[model samples]
Target chain A: MNKSYLYLFVRFVVLIALQVLIIDHINLGGYINPPLYILFILLLPFETPGWFLLLSAFALGFSIDIFSNSVGLHTASCVFMAYMRPTIIRAVGAPADYEAYLNPGIPDMGTQWFVFYTLFLTLLHQLAFGILESFYFAEAGIIFIRMIASSLFTLVLIVLIEYLFMSRKK
Target chain B: MRHILAFIWKHNFFFLFLVLEILSVVLLVNKSYYQRAVITNLTDRFTGSINSTYSSITGYFYLKQENDKLAAENAVLWQSLKHGLVTTDTLTTQLVDTLNRQTYRYTVAKVVSNSTGKRNNYIMLNKGKRHGIEHDMAVISPNGIVGTVVSVSDNFSWVMSVLNKHSKVSARIDRLGQMGTVLWQGQNPDKGSLTDIPVHVKVIKGDTIYTSGFSHIFPEGVMVGTVETIKVKEGDHFYDIGFKWSADLNGLSHVYIVKNLFREEQVELSKQVIDE
Candidate 1:
């Protein structure tokens, strides 16, 4: 248990470093800088307690906000994602999946289930982020376009990273 | 008490989520960069240095472009030193009733971190309070006006860029002398919308814009941008206009923080007048 906690901590540092230093600078078309740090929240252990999950999510998102010099967009979005993660997993997985599996990943959960899980979570996260940033009904069209474009872009990267890195997990 | 405790334990997730979400929402609503939060301050120190380190490595790629721009600006500066074209000294001297008194001071600072990709973009400078930088100072680049200082840490200052939605610059058409406000309505880092110009003004294409110096944040007649496009709808009171900034905010690295020596006096005098 201690080893797993340490592992998550190390992952948080590495992912946050990569995010603020590298991914944040990749301004594609002055629009789609895919915030890849949320992968930390995504890759958390499925058995993570409610308080732990929400607190870690807040920490991760707040760190991003600090680097990006915003306030609550990422924090709220990540916490909301963490809050919804269990429901999302159950929605996209079998009833017996949690009892059978030790974790959530492409390797452990299978390709189809992981993809659907990641898709719903990223879409939802990006939508929340977009709405918080813009806060306008008139620019809903632009927000939708941006949310979809960014979500898909980050989704591909997330899946590819998971497949390459966590391929050995299962 | 036992029942309430048991009930809370039964659905702790919902309660935790609600509390965390509410805290995040409060942070968002406040959105003040200068908030006295230790967590944010620590992160700012870490993030500021990290950004500067990363930018130093990436700064090599833009060396050629930046050097060329500096050289071009040097030529203009050299020409002015030798009385090139019309003397702009007279024009600037007119701002000061007394001759040879400098009302503005400029401090050189490097842009360690900048972003033009957001709805409300910002720039971070290497200079801060220790370097004589303060809040509300004007930051201008060799190319054009950049932003205004919003907050200052020990070694870093945050600048709210002119491209930000909340930023408004009192500007004037150079040739026509028609005054208007320039603001960014989100998107387009290179372009900002010029508003409040009455429809009767004959605003031609390619008209130059300069800071009006009415706001007291920026000095008089700094190059703001140039008129790029204009459209007028029937019966509209003001002309719909967009101007391209003289500075390419994406490529900005070096800038000067403008400190107005007379600003306090001016503001105080205005306040005194208003008190009557």
Candidate 2:
């Protein structure tokens, strides 16, 4: 448990830093702006306490918000995605009795479940973030386009990261 | 109480979800730019549209007052334009001063009531004897002649609209200089006929027709209408002319009633000549 906590803490700092310093500045022609810090929530162990999950999600979102100069948008979307994680896991019929030390990742969950989990959470996060950022019905079309493009971009990056770095379960 | 506590404990995650959602909302609303944009978008979609629709409805109610102010301003412009040049140049001072008489005065009046569907269509104006509007004064809109005042009360006057069967005005072809009388045929509000234009004159389909100033009611060169068609039957000495109406009489809201300053003097002189 202690080792996993430490791992989560380290992952949090690395992802937040990467998101703020590099990804935030990248402009793919002002479209497909990937937000990868959401991987932090997706990687959290299924056994995490609900309140702790919510708090950590808020903290991660707030940190990204501070860096991006978008005050509450990232924080709100992150917390919302975190709140929705269990429902998504249940809907996807993940094993009810998850290992205490195990996390939702490419190595443990296989390629299909991991992709589905990551893409679902990323889509939800991007939706909340985009809708909050552009608060107008007239902008719904452009917002939908941005959300889809950014979600796909973020999903690809997260799957690539997990495949390249995570140890395969034997 | 224990059941309630158990229920609360059982649904603790949902409560946490609700609480966290509330907190995020508060942050979103209280934060700068992004949150404001969200709130603005939500309210703009819902309340903003309602407010705009409401204002648009109320805006229609204000059009009458706005039109009244516009008509009054137009009256001043028309008065100055018809009164001739008030010269300040030293060389033309003596010559221009003699010419600059206030031969015409104008009063802005709202069309309180109007009709085009009626054969003897009459327009009721908001101004009457109290506002210096008298019977026989000519009425015109910004576009063209509307009618002549036929009767007046203390605060209201009735006008003979150009669509009325009794209405007649001396008009001429602007390019041809051929004088004709414009009279309504008691049908077709959009059209009128120019009578007494002889067949020998070259009347084209698009020639402009204007007031001939012979009636002493309307000013010279005021737009009447454009000649729409010209027909000359065999053995007929006069051309049958149909002209399209220049002013939208059915939708008239603002009009100027012309008060000719020299009208009474002209009438008296003409009457004396008739009596002799």
Candidate 3:
């Protein structure tokens, strides 16, 4: 198997395990539930096909929903993030041809671009997830608050994980 | 046909991802009803274990506080015991006897793991099905009511905390006897809202709120909270009353699960007339 594909598979397994076994039970605050599984989508190889990216995102979210017992909320949010990924990437002027299998890194793409990408994706994911989870229009304000709080938490974790672990890799 | 086949082969990974995503969405949207039961059960077990681990770690720090609270509660129980005889000696024994009958029973349990910050906060208690904790049992802290039992296992149970948006408890004013539904607004863990309170009824910010005992889940007079604020819209028939929850759900350590002995029979009988 290709080294990159092997790395992706191992990371995917580890992420899923950590999410279900550890993060799901770690309730930092009433409003903040960090969704680290989203890193699976964020870390995908740049050359991964559009259809594959969208599908992987959905699968990742659906697995979490299944475990958490929330219906369809995660799936919807994951798909929304997947759909928006390309637009954000293009607007930020990252490499167009993604055939080189370049990993998304701050050092490679510059800190500003990386921050914008993470913030946009994290916010989009949280907003879609929170609204769908509430499923009630009357609770829009409460859901928005929850989304913002969770997004902030998730962004911090994402950056920290990337900085500490992925950044050290060759 | 050969060109099409080549194209498909070239994008197999893309197609595979799409298929997986669609499959996930379908599973999420069409989650089997039975799956909910299984997931809830699994969650309860996992939460229970986590809570126990946390409790064990934190138990050392709380021993002094727990001992003091227990001593205080014991004193109250002793005083009540002493008063029971004196009251019976003076009043109409029959009326007082009937009034004194235990309408509710409680199962004491240690909080293994408890949380108040999540949108759907749940507490894990050390005692469970074997200890007489069943679904819908009211879980209370020393201060006041916390939540209702949602799932139970052999050795542990999960209480959906009052902070949860899905929690709804029937409550009434302590002084005026006016009734309303208490619901968590999800804005603050320590506060909730009392809806359907008639505007005409006299209500004040400091008035006490207690469970109405209309719901089989909780007995009458279980302290829920005190009215924090009352907003009566002009021309509206009801007031939006805010409640400051008495139970400090965030710092839960010990809890009592209230079991309604007649709940099963009552539910079965009521089910014959009303679809519950």
Q: Kindly list the per-residue Cα lDDT of model 1 for residues A1-170, writing each as its tens digit.
A: 78888999999999999887778666677667687888888888777788999999999999888877777879999999999998997798744745633677877777788778888999989888888887878878878887888889988999999988999855
**Please, what are the lDDT tens digits per residue for candidate 2 over residues B45-111?**
3322333344345447659866776788678788777256565677676676788998889898876
Best by DockQ: 1
lDDT tens digits, residue span B1-276, model 3: 999989988976556556655665565556464664566566656545655776788788889988888898888788888464565455576666778757689888888766565666667778877887777899887778998987777887767888876789999999999889999877777788999989878898899999998889988898999888889888999999988989877777888999888888888988988864
What overall lDDT, based on C-alpha atoms, would model 1 receive against the true structure?
0.85
Docking class of 3: acceptable
Worst 10 residues of 1 chain B by lDDT: B31-40
Q: How close is candidate 2 to the true structure, as a TM-score?
A: 0.45
Order candidates by DockQ, high to low: 1, 3, 2
DockQ for each model: 0.67, 0.10, 0.32
Model 1 Cα lDDT, one tens digit per residue, B1-276: 999999988999999999999999898888554563444456668878888998899999999988898899899888876356675687665655556788899999998888877777789898988899888999999878999998788888889999776799998998988899999867566788899999987998899999999998999899988889999888899998998999878888899999999999999999999999
lDDT of 2 by residue, A122-156 (tens): 88988888777656677677678778888888889
TM-scores for all predictions = 0.91, 0.45, 0.80
Candidate 3 clash pair list: A30-B117, A30-B118, B51-B112, B51-B113
Candidate number that wins on DockQ, 1 or 3: 1
Error of 1 at B36 (Å): 5.1
- Quantify all predictions' global Cα lDDT against the true fold: 0.85, 0.76, 0.77
